[model samples]
Target: MHDSSHHSVDPVLAVLRQYFGFEAFRGFQREVIDHLLAGQDAIALMPTGAGKSLCYQIPALLLPGMVVVISPLIALMQDQVAALWQNGIRAAFLNSTQSSQESAKVMQLARQGAIDLLYLAPERLLMEHSLTFLSQIPIVLFAIDEAHCVSQWGHDFRPEYLGLSVLSERFPTVPRLAVTATATALTRDDIIKYLKLQQAKLFIASFDRPNIHYTVVAKNDPKQQLKRFLDAEHLHDAGIVYCLSRKRVEEIAEWLVQNGRRALPYHAGLDKETRQRNQSQFLQEEGVIIVATIAFGMGIDKPDVRFVAHLDLPKSLEGYCQEIGRAGRDGLPANAFLTYGYEDVIKLRRLLINSQLTENLARSARQQLDTMLAYCETTNCRRQMLLRHFNEAYSHACGNCDNCRAPVSTWDGSIAAQKALSCVYRTGQRFGVEHLIDVLLGKKTERIIALEHMQLSTFGIGSDLDARQWRSVFRQLIAADLLVIEPVYGGLRLTERCRPVLRGEQAIRFRQDAKAPIAVKKDVQAKRGTLSVHHHSKELWQTLKKLRQDIARQQGVPAYCIFHDATLQELIDKRPITEQDLSKIYGIGSRKLKEYGADLLRIMKQFAPDGIDV
Candidate 1:
């Protein structure tokens, strides 16, 4: 709960309430800001929607000199700077997209102490000219965004991040703050070590996002499945559909549009202009879907994404978590659906094996894949499994996942596991899932005959089940650590864990895949019971959004930069009549209240003449 106090009374709380329109700091925001204000280095491991940006944004306002933020993505910097400008903060970004004059003007402002926060990419900051210019400025502090990129163990590792240590070398006295939304224990250690934040205070917020309901299903007719999920669960809502390849992204985008949905394609393969335009549309327009490869959503700040769907398996759980974390950023109910098949596993394994990664890095990547597969196959609780990967423990089940909603049927899979292990061992463990399944199904194919695997003692011994069932059994074996894929040759091999199951000393239970839901329900609603104006105030909400969209277009900013859906929800709830009444609503900062107060009040009066109190 917020403190419910006006900002003109207290300085720190005033900055929060006046600009950001929040009455209080969430999680470790105040602690981290206090540490930074005391001239101490810190590291914050907050979840995506946990207000990581505010931890630094608020401090920059209180600190004396300009705060230099090392951001990774250009789009991220643009979004952050724009949001800051909307808050009436003096923020600027120096990026490759800016013209020479624009860049010089921004730096001149920073040099003149006119900018409170300045964002620069790591690559640009490490340049000789930029460093020379930065050396001349009075930098109060340095912030490293997406600090996990400094570690090889991180999913989005970038070599340029290694040069960020120069900040500590060049400006040894200035406090440094490193922030990341997703970092494992190893990644955290790597970030501290690599960024040289030896004495930094570590702040880790709870990784749980209770509003996001996770659902992982077996991929059967993936395109149709995604369409059904979208049509049934999230009609006319903004969401992101992630595909593994650019072709798939374009195909999905086109398919969605053909099916009477508004969608756009975004990926690295698209022309830069097209990609930027599509991304802008996704950010600016309401209920526009963006079908993209993983490259599209590094630092997207859109808060009303109602869903994030994955048509293929991610390479690791970290990537999966980071991607799914994009939804429900507004603390509203959202959905994350992932559809995976055995083919996804095999394809990912082959890609990892054929990559140019060093041995250690490759091994770490394979381990991550194994963890992701375990997560996809787990039937206990999806949120629990996800949190446990980050060393967070949960004793009870989260009722929001598919498992808790509809329990899966489990069977004593020891005998089936033994048959799978025997097939791997007897076939010399050199074949992939296709040939292994063929052998298990007693199919007399040319490859099977060529390998002469037919004469093996375990051959055709377990023909009771079909190939699909065998595939499921083998997938569970891999998930359970009884079998592993040999990275070098991309073949299945038995692990030490297989010995117990094969010896009948251990019993294993495996979940059969849940039947896909024919049609999921649309479940996203703001404020639950408090939002009783669903039918009555529907027109009012649409009118408010249209007004916001028109103003955003005039200002050339994203619609959310004008007002968030949560803020609009407040307007619908309060039915404010006068300027003072509008100013009291949540997210209506003083600056916004003064600038658009009359217009908003008029809209409210038009909608709720009888309900207006003033």
Candidate 2:
């Protein structure tokens, strides 16, 4: 008989090898997985594409029985189930789109211990019937996707999600896992308390995606800016164009299709079928673009999206990161472009001020918005600034972003920064950016005259720079850690870091903020090191993919479940000759080698002699 210990390999590593087919775990996946496998609750704060799904999915598969996943959006649930089905996994979902009969069938399967995973909306989980149904099943784990929604202090809080604490009392024995792409320290605490997962292990992955190039441009003809961005960066790649309004989504989708691109529109305004059809087209077709609002892409499972462009200011940096995370999941290079005007700030502030939340909550939300605005206006490395907001330090600039690729020139701003800091000090650190700019520009406006600040020694020291230039200086000062904005007081203040610059002991350099250069149109050139396989070898790869697809389809699994992109690349590169050689490849264990190994070997032999000797 097989030893139980051999069967009981580290539960996390076992799932990594069996389902996801990775030989090892990535960044906190092993730790988080182990925590959940030990039947402890967990809250994982990983960035997009950081394998958040694996943390729960692995533990669910490894435990004694079924794992119930509570998701927010129906589209997200369907997409996840479809991807899992392609991988030969028995996963199903109960959402609004399902017919009652279909829901009943899925419930029956769950009762018989046949289904391994089940997905439901948070509201559905709160239903009495749903609770009754769940109580009958041997649920080993309860997973909450997008756990930030549980906190009203979070950007995407949902009331139904707040009610999810019932799961803790209803099934006290099951471990719980809460996963989100982004969360601040306060939001993290709120999630634990609200979900009643106080005992959960906390895993916070580095909030960095080095492969995504972040860029923010001034809102100069945003439509034209978007057109230029798509033309220069992602002409024939999958991407999402986010808008704040439904009308804008429709217009952008139409414009993209008219410009010889495949595009679709998605929002709550559309009927369910239309939205689903558009989403399906985007998933199945190459180079398809989806123009959408914030309502789209919550749980989307697309792996090769090449870009995510925002036509207006995002609600928060967390939202922005989550949206861009949709791209480059396949470990490929991608881009995130954002454009916003001054009016966006006014509109966002009004939205926040109109909310009925407590004053402290609104204040926190506004601060988060200010941080996002600072990011947009920054001339420094966008990646560095973003990571810094999450309390993580980035020592070097990412060489891929638009700013880093073409760095902005810097001027000696030590004197100007000192003058600004002095003005804030003289004014008792209680003035906003406009008042500060007026003092520097030496404007004889009524407000300035009323304050009688023109007579101060540092009043007119910065008269050389205009309003826009002064704005850039202040933004840079904040980014450089010299100035701090207190949202509570609605004013600017100096941090201790500014003392050295004021004393002339530290020199301050500022990026000369200027308009982005107009990209000259050029003929497309092939990327270097991207190989064009021989026609025979190309056929072999295609045959291998077809075989994998056929087996996955027959087994009701995801295509990646059979072979990941890296594994496929290895097969093309190594062309393993024997079953022994095949077994040595990553993701190809003895069982998989025996099952599909000969077919791949035969295809390789048809194209090359000896079929890559072991």
Candidate 3:
């Protein structure tokens, strides 16, 4: 048995307890921190909101000298630095957003040993001068946030990240930590290889986020459907609306704003200030809606976003999960609203086929999309299907999603699934979903006759089911493992496991496809009203948030990056009077107390003298 007492209290844990006020680590934080503190390189695959930042943040504080965090997006870096400052940690970031004098001041602080953490964009770090300057600092730890971007095959790839291996080579003695929320097995291997962290410890956290409800609506009159989704049940909830194109983002943002919703547009085409301003407003204000393209939402740290609605199908499951993971970071219930249609799949496939990546990468991307499509189309428990994709076992059906809460009537689809599988085998497994659908529905058009699929015995076997029913059967068959899609061959194929069912030796079951859930209308008056202010000490929370934001802005960072909602809630619950009392609150550290300890105390003094002041 392991000796629990021998596990010495990590210096970082002390900082965590002193500054953040948390008594223990969450998820893989303890093990990951231990590995890094031991001076080892490591790669962490954690789901969003799993405290991946803490794995590095704690080490940065505990280890003597500075930690250089290489990140891709300037917005993300700003947010992270702001969050560090809120905990009273001295943190600075060098990115494109800063002027020359500002950059010089930050660098000077690093050289003078005044800063504990410094955030750098990968592109900025690639500069010769920056690297030379970085070498001078007593670098304790090097962290690569969003490490998956190093992989060319990843959904979000940055060529600059490829050269980050030099950091390990130049500072061979310094520990390195790389973290990302999404990575397939392939992406994981690529990150390890590209970053040259072969000997690094690996931590893979459970991918399940049970608080987010998953639902997919069939794409028919999507605009009307979206309107129904935004109605009163979700009113007053901050959410993101993802669009496929810049034009759609603008149009949707305009529509929502015109309808009196606090909405804004965000896309690559928008000016940097506008995008930054919109994102900041959304983060600070309640019930703000951000309509954006895929270009938005990387490294965003919003915790209370109530839902993430997709106006268009995402390119891959990795992208989808990362996007939706932004919601409910505070562990409250959230929704993932997806609208799917045949055209979306076709467009996604065409985009994948057109990409310059190798056939293998393209195939893998396509397979991921297919899996997402299966989840969207599945009539099974939404949570179970999502969990199963990540190799997790989830037995009970989640009753919160659209399907389970309002279940659709399902008929026995054993015969339909059998016919769909039969078509794949009879066609030599060379046909895709469309062709197979034709064969089952007895549609002997030119292409059908040209392929001589008319000769298949299963051609008319599924004639009883209409085109929609047959399509549903094919979808269900793939989900049940009775059928598999061959991405390389660009078609569907029957698996060996399908034999028993074909021969009637085994039974096949399927949930008849449920009709799309009806959209509920929102009460306009309710949506336009302000968030109900309920506070035992309303003035105290406001004062806390104001001081937090002022300090964050001066530090050139995002507000929440300083302190999470939970930590702020704690301040309201028990106002800390002394540094010791503050240390007892979750997420407070000595470094943070040294920085913001006085400010917190002053705020409490302004309210109640006998009340504890930080």
Every model's Cα RMSD, please? 3.5, 6.2, 6.5
lDDT of 1 by residue, 1-614 (tens): 87757534767788998887787888889999989999999999998888898888888898788998999988778878887888889999999999999999998998899999999999999999999999999888898998999988876889999999998898899999999988898899999898999899999989999988888888889988898888766877899999988889989999999999999999888898899899999998889999988887877899999899999999988998899889978887788999988678777888887889999989888888888988888888989999998889987999878888777789888888888899899888887887888887788899989988888877787688777788788778877888877755668989887898889999999888655753443343333222234787889988999999999999888998888888898899878787767767877888788778888988887887564465
- Model 3, CA-based lDDT: 0.78
In every candidate, how many clashes are there? 0, 10, 22
Model 1 misplaced stretches (Cα beyond 4 Å): 1-8, 424-466, 486-491, 518-533, 609-614
Whole-model lDDT per candidate: 0.86, 0.78, 0.78
Local error of candidate 3 at residue 180 (angstroms) = 1.0
Q: Which residue runs does candidate 3 get wrong by more than 4 Å?
A: 1-10, 393-409, 414-510, 516-563, 567-614
Ranking by TM-score: 1, 3, 2
Which candidate achieves the best TM-score against the true structure?
1
lDDT of 2 by residue, 1-614 (tens): 76687666565566566555568878988888777878888889988887788777776667778999999988668768865654446789998788999999999999999888899999999999999999999998999998988877665779999899999999999989999986888789889888998888788889888777777776667878988878876776789999988998999899888888898999989998999889877765557899999888876777768789999899788788889989877665677888876556656766776678788988787777778877876667888988887888899988766677667777998888888889889877888778988887787889889989888776777878888888777766765657766644447779988888999999988767656644423421123111234566677767776877687668654455566545776777887777666765766754566667788787666656564443
- Which 10-residue window in model 3 sums to the lowest lDDT? 524-533
Best by lDDT: 1
User: On a 0 to 100 scale, what is the lDDT of residue 572 in model 3?
Assistant: 71
